[model samples]
Target chain A: MVRLNNLQKEYKGFKLNVSLEIPEGCVTGLIGRNGAGKTTTIKSILGLVKPTAGEIEVFGKAPVELTAKEKQQIGVALSESGFCMIFTIEDVIKVLKASYEDFNEDEFRNKCTAQSLPFDKQIKDFSSGMKAKLRVLTAMSHKAKLLILDEPTAGLDVIARNDILALIRKYLEEDPTRSIIISSHISSDLEGLCDDIYMINDGKIILHEDTDRLLGNYGLIKVSSEEFETLDKKYIVASQKDRFSVTCLTSEKQFYIDNYPKTVIENAHIDDIIVLMLDTSKEG
Target chain B: MKIIINNTSMVPVYEQLMDQIKQEIIGGGLKEGDALPSVRNLAGELKISALTVKKAYDKLEEDGFTVTVHGKGSYVAATDIPLALEARRKAVEEEFSEAVSKARSAGLEDDEIREILEILLEDS
Candidate 1:
C-alpha cells in the first residue's frame, strides 16, 4: 500500500534515508529510539516533509500528488499534531464530518462516549490518554484503507496503550484488506501488532525482518569470556564485552540451541534488537 | 478454542499457536470438520498480527491437521488417529527427554528422575 525507495530527507546534521514497503493487508512497524528519524520517515511518507531525494509511493501515486479522493483513502494520526486545542470533541466531530465523505459520525460519537471522552469539553482540557484515544478514533472513523499512525500510544499508561492497540486491531478486523504503518518506540506494541518491523537508526534502515522470524530466530547468547572464546562465532551478528562476560546477538538461534546446549541463550526481543544492533562493538 | 500467547516465550507466536491448535485437535476439543475462526477474527481476538495467525493456519494445513477452502475459512481435517497419536507421543517423548536432561544437569540421579516421573504420572 506504501513504498519508499531510497527516500532521503536532510536536515543539518541529521539525514534519513530509508526504503520500506507496506503491502496490502499488512501492519508494518517503524521502530527506533528518539531522534532516530522515525517521525521524519513518517512525515516523508505522508508528504508532510519534502524528501531531499528519492521517491515515496502511496497507493500507486506519490503522496504529494494524491487527489482529494485518493487522500481520503489514507488515515493519519500524528503524535505532535491534532485539532485546535480550543475545539471541543463535538466541534471536532463537526469539522471531520465536513472534511471526509466517509466519516461515520455515529461511530465516532459512540467511540468517544465509550472511551469516556467528554464531547463538550475542549481538547486542551482532555487528559493525555483521552487525547490519544480521540486521535485514533478520528483516524479510524473515516474508514480509510491505510492508517499512518505515528506514536499513537506514546506516553500513555499500560491500560491506555492496550486500548489504543485494541482499537487499531478492531479497525483492521473490520476490513481485512486495510494496511497500517505504526511507528513507535514502544517495542511491545509493535511486537504484538506488526507483521514485520523496520528498525531505523540515525538516518538509515538498520534492519528489516518479519516478526515471526525475528521472534523465532534471533537470540542473545550470554557467556563468560572464556566460554565466549571457545564459542563458534559463525552465527554471531553483534557482541559486547562486559567486565567478566559477553553478550552476543545471533540471528541463527536454532544453530546455537542445537550446538551450544550449555550456553545461556535468551530470546531476542525488539528492545534487545535495538540495543544490540545499535551497539558499536564488532563481532570477532 | 481458547488460545493463550506467551509473548516472552522463546518459541515464536505462530508456532505456539500451531501447537495449541494441534493439541486441541488431538485432545478432541476441536473435532474434524469444525470451522476454525477466520484469520482476521482470530488475529483480533489474540491481539496478534493476522499474518501470524495465517502462517499458523497454513502450517496446520500443510501438516494435514486442517484444510483451507478459499472464502470458506479453515476447518479441522479428518485425522489418521494412529498417526496423530504417534506424533503426540513423539512430542511428549521429546519433552520428557528435555526434562530428564535438565534434571541431570541440575545433578539429579537417574533413579531420582525416574521416581519423580513416576510420581507425576500417578498424580496425572
Candidate 2:
C-alpha cells in the first residue's frame, strides 16, 4: 500500500506533482514518455530524491523514515545502473545477504542459475537482458511485500519480458497482500500487467483510471469540423487536430457509437492515450 | 477450457474471454462441475493481467456460469437448461441475422440467401 497526497517536486523548469495511491494486492502502472517525470516520481517513492512540496508515504511512513525491517518488505529494481558493475554475481549475493534480514541466499542463487546467469561472471560483462533479469531476480528473491519495478523489462526482447512477467505473476501468487508499482514506456507490458494506470506528462498527472475501464470505454473519434461542432463535448478527455479533421479522445465510446452512429470511433489503446495526453498541438 | 482472443479487434479481452467461456459451457465442451484454472494460472498461460482474468471470472460467477470458492478455484455451475437454451438460441439468431445482413449488403437476393442456407442445412 503506497499513497502520495499532493506530492510535489521541483527541478528548475519541471515541477512534478501527482496525487495517487497503489492499493494493496494490485499492480499499479505509472506510464509516461521520456522526461515525463516517471523516474522522478519513482525516486520520490524510493526516497532517492526529496520532494520540494507535498508529502509521500510508503507502507504508512515517510520513505526516508522506512526502517531496515520495513525496507526488507520492499523490493526495488531501477532501470538505470543497478548494483555495482565491477562486483561479480557471488559478491553481490554476499552483499545482499548481509544487507537484508530476510535475504535467502539459496533462493537467490537458485533463481540466478534458473535464469542462466553465471555466478562467476562480473555484471559489466553481462548482456542487457541478463542484467535486467539479475536486477529483477535480486529484487524478487527475498519475498518482498511490495515490488517497485522501474522498467523491469526495458531493452529486453519479447522472450525475456515474458519470462520476467511470468516470474512477477508467480511472486504475486505467493502472497495475497503484495503489491507493485511498475513504470514502463511499453504500453503492452502495462496493458496486461496493471490493475490501474496513471499517465504523467509535463510533471502533471493526466489520467488515473482502472485498466479495464480505460481499455474498454475510452476511444478515439476522427470527425470533420462540422461534426465536431455539433458533437457533445462532455466525453472528450484530450484532443488533437489538423485542418481537415479533429481526432478527439473520448472515454464514452459507447455513447458516441450509439448516438453518433455515423461517426467513426476507434479504440484508444494505452499507447494512443499516452500520445494524445502528452502531445498537445491544437486542442479541441 | 481454452479461449483465443484478437487484441486488435473491437471486443475487449475480458469480454472475449467471457463470451468464449459461456459458449463452451453451453456447447457442453466444458461440463458442469468442471474446475476452471486458477486466476494466476490462467493469467500466466494467457500472458495477460491477473486482473483481466479476475474480471472475466467475476463476470462468469455473477452470471451463474461458474461458482468460485474463496481459497479454492472456480467451477462451472449447473445451468438452468431453459435459460441456457434461450441464451444459445439468441446467440445463434444474432449470428444468423448478421450473416444475412452481410449477404444482403453484398447484393444477394433474399431467395439466394434462403437457398444458400437450405443447401447448407441439407448438406450437413
Candidate 3:
C-alpha cells in the first residue's frame, strides 16, 4: 500500500504536486507524457528525491524513515542502470545478496533463466533490455512486497516485455499482500495490469480512478449539426467544429443519446481521453 | 469455452471476461470444480495485463462462481445456483435496456434499435 498526500517536488522550471494512493494488492499506473513529472513522482515515493512539501507512506511506514529490513520489502527498477556497468552479473548478485536480507539466490537464477540473460557477462556488454531485466531481476529476487518499475519495458521486444510482465504477475501472486507501481509511457502495458490509473500533466494529477470506471464514464458523440443543436450543452466535454458538423466528448453519452435521437455515440478510449484533456487544458 | 469479447464493443476487457465467464458457468460449459486459466496465462493470450485478468477472476470469486487457492490457482466453486440462468438473463436484459434507452434518446425507434442489434448479432 502506498499513500501520497499533497506531495510536491520542485525543479527549476517544473513542479510535481500530486496526491494519490496505490491501494494494497493492486497495480496502480502512473501515466503521463514526457516531462510530465511522472518520474519525479516515482522518485519521491522511493525517497530518491526529497519532497519540497507534503508526505508519503509506503506500506504504513514513511519511505524516508524505512529501516533496512523494511527496505527489503520494496523493489525498485528505474529506466537507467543503477549498477556499475563494469560489474559482472555474478558480482552484482553477490552485492545484492549482501544488500538485502531476503535476497534469494534461487529466485535470481530463475529470473536470469526466464529473461535468458548471461549471468557471467559484464553489464556493459548487455543490451538495454538485458540491463533492464537485470535490474528487475535484482530488485524482484529480494521477494519485495511492493515493486516500483519506471519504464521497465520502454525499449524491449514484445516477447521480452511480455516475459517481464508475466514474471511480475507471478511475483505478485506469490503473496496476496504484494503491490506494484508501474510507471510507463505505454498505456497498453498499464491497461491489462493496473487496477487503477493516475494521469498526470503539468506535474499535477489530471485524473485518478479505477481503470474500468474511467473507461465506462467517458464516450465520444458524433452528431450532425441538426442533432448537435438539440443536445444539452452541459453534457459536452470537448468539441471540434467544422463546416459540416461537430464532434464532442461527453461523460453522459446516454443523456445525449436519449435527447438528440439522431446523434452517434461511440465508446471512447483511455488514449483519447488523455489527448483531449491535455488539449483542453492547453486551450483553457 | 464460448467467450465473446467484442474488442470494439465499447465494453472494457475485464467486463468482457466477466460476462463471458459468468455466461459459461450459467450455460454449464464451465462446471463446478472446473479450472480457470491462470491470470498470467489468460492475460498473455489476450495480450493484456495480468491485472485485468485478475480483476475478472477476483470478481468471479467474489460472486461465488470461482475460488482461488493461493499459489495454486482459480477453480469453479461447487455452489447452489438455483437461479444462475435467471440471474444471467436479467443481467443481459439490463444491459439491453441501458443500450436501448441511450439509443432511443438519440432519436432511434425500437425497430431501428432492433435493426442495429440484429446487425450486431449477425456479425457476432
Candidate 4:
C-alpha cells in the first residue's frame, strides 16, 4: 500500500499538496492536465523528486530509504525517460538484468515478441507506441508488487492502449495484494481500470472517489435559469453555464431521478467530471 | 455465460454484467452448480478491470443469485420454482414501470398505451 499525507512540494513558483491512499489491492488512478503536478507527485513517491514538505510512505517505509529489495518490489514506467533512446532492446535487457535481482530475461523477450516490439532497433528509432510498450514490458518483466505508471497509454493508438491495460490487469492477477498508481490524460483508461480515482488541479487533489461510485452516482442536469433556481441546490457539487443553460453536477444521479421527475438528468462521465471539477471558476 | 459490455453505454459496466448474468441464470443458460470462470480469466477475456468482475460477483452473491466458494469460484445458486418465476416477473415489472414512465412523459393516455401494448403482444 502507498500513502501520501499532506504531501507538499515547494518549487520556485509552484507548490503541490496531495493526500491519498492507494489501497493494498486496487488500482488508484491519478488524472490531471499537463503541469498539474502529476509527474511531480509520482516522482515524489519514487523519491526521484525531493519534496520540501510532506510524507510519502511506500509499504510502510520511506521510498528513498527503502532497501534494494524493497525498491525492486516496485516497477516504474515514466514517460519519455527511464530507458535511454539510443539503447536497443538488447541493451535494455542487459541493463535491467544488472539492475534488478529478479529480472526475468526470458519473460521480457516473450513479452516483446507478443507485443510485436522489435529488439533490433534502438529506443530512439521506435515509434511512440513501441516506446510505450517497451517501458511497460520492462516494468512488468520483474515481479513488482506495485506499478507506478505515468501516462502509460498516452499518444498510443487504441490497440496499444488496450495492450498496456491488459498487461496491467495481468500484473494484478499475479498477486492479489498488488497495487498500482497510474496517471494519464485518458479518462476512459481510468474509468475502466481504476478502483479509485483522484483528480488534481493547481497541484492539489480536487476529487477522490471510488470509480463505481463516480460512474454510478455522478450526474449532470441541464436546466433553464428558472428551473435551476427552483431545483434543490444542495445536490450541486459544481455548476457551469453559458448562454444556453446551466449544467449542475449532482453527486447522486438516482436521487435526483427519483425526486425531480421533471428535470432531465445525464450520466456524468469521468471526462466531463474532470472538465467540470477542474474548472476553478465553477468548482470553487 | 457470455456478457457484452458497452463502455459508452449509460449503464455502468458492472451493472450491465450483473443484469446479463442474472438473466442467464433465470433463463437456465447458466445451470445451478455450474462453475463460473475465475475473476481474472473473465476480466481478461472481457478486457475489463478485474475489480469490475469482483464487484459484479459481490453484488450477485449479496443478492443470493450466485454463491462463491472461497478458493474455488462462483456458481449459480439453486432456486425454487416460485422464486424463479418471481425473478422473471420482477425483471418484466422493472421494464414495464420504465415504459409507463416514458409513455406518460410522451403524453400517451392509459387507453392508448394499453392499445399499443395489445398490438405488440399480438404480434409477438
Tell me, by lDDT, which candidate is best: 1
Question: Can you write out model 2's per-residue Cα lDDT over B1-124, one digit (the tens) per residue?
Answer: 6789777666777999999998888888889899998886776677677788899999999999999988888999987856978977899999999999999999999999999999999999
Q: Roughly what TM-score does model 2 have, to 2 decimal places? A: 0.88
Cα RMSD for candidates in order: 3.6, 3.5, 5.7, 3.6
What global local distance difference test value does model 3 have?
Answer: 0.80
Model 2 is docked with a DockQ of 0.44
lDDT of 3 by residue, A105-160 (tens): 88788779767898778889998878888877776888788999998888888877
Scored against the true structure, residue B58 in model 2 reaches a CA lDDT of: 98
List DockQ, one per candidate, in order. 0.60, 0.44, 0.31, 0.39
Rank by lDDT, highest first.
1, 2, 4, 3
* Candidate 1 docking band: medium
CAPRI accuracy category, model 3: acceptable
**Candidate 1 structure quality by residue, lDDT tens digits, A169-200:** 88988888999999999999998889899998
RMSD of 4: 3.6
Q: Candidate 3: lDDT of A76?
A: 92
Q: Pairing residues by index, what is the TM-score of model 3? A: 0.80
- Greater-DockQ candidate between 3 and 4: 4
Candidate 1: segments with Cα more than 4 A from true spot: A281-284, B86-117, B122-124
Candidate 1, residue A200: the lDDT equals: 89
Better of 1 and 2 by TM-score: 1
